[model samples]
Target: MKNKIVAALLAFFLGIFGVHKFYLGENLGGILYLLFSWTFIPGFLAFFDFLGLLLMSDQAFNAKFNPGIPYSVLDGSRSAQDITVALSQLKKLYDQDAITAEEYEEKRRKLLNEL
Candidate 1:
């Protein structure tokens, strides 16, 4: 997960080169920032980014940078590791005939869809 403080710091310091953009997975933005750093446009934009980061809510930040990952997964309520283990166990049960084919497919689909 991307931390707001880290992003803000990078924007404030190395934003001329778009370090925060790279950190946030905006590779194209980062490259553009690097390309235009001499022009000072990226640095100007970075200042606004720093200000925006300061004003953004944690939930909004997560929704933007960490899409597709639920808070529960981050909090360990139900994680990808747990899901993977469950899938392996479910496959074993199915292979051993502990579950019928239809039941296995239904359960597998439900688990996979969560990922």
Candidate 2:
């Protein structure tokens, strides 16, 4: 779970090194930033990133960074529905014999406990 404040801080401070890009899981963008860091382009880009972070909502941030995962800001955690769906998928895998029974049981217990 990445924090907006942390990403903004990284952009403000170490964005020249593409730290914020890496933090956001944008490896290609991070590498490009690194390649052009000496040209001051990354600094300018980082400034824009800082502004973007300030402007972006938490839901937008999560959607951009976390992708398919559903996040619940009220509890600062994943939604129970997502966990249940994952458990159901795990069961399907187990039924197909894709995973050992022991593995399925362990994962099922872990997922249930998360609820």
The lDDT per prediction is 0.91, 0.88
lDDT tens readout by residue for model 2, 26-77: 8999999999999999999999999999899988988888776566633546
21, model 2: CA deviation in Å? 0.4
Best by TM-score: 2
* lDDT of candidate model 1 versus the reference: 0.91
Off by over 4 Å in 2: 77-115
Estimate the overall C-alpha local distance difference test score of candidate 2: 0.88
RMSD of each: 8.3, 3.8
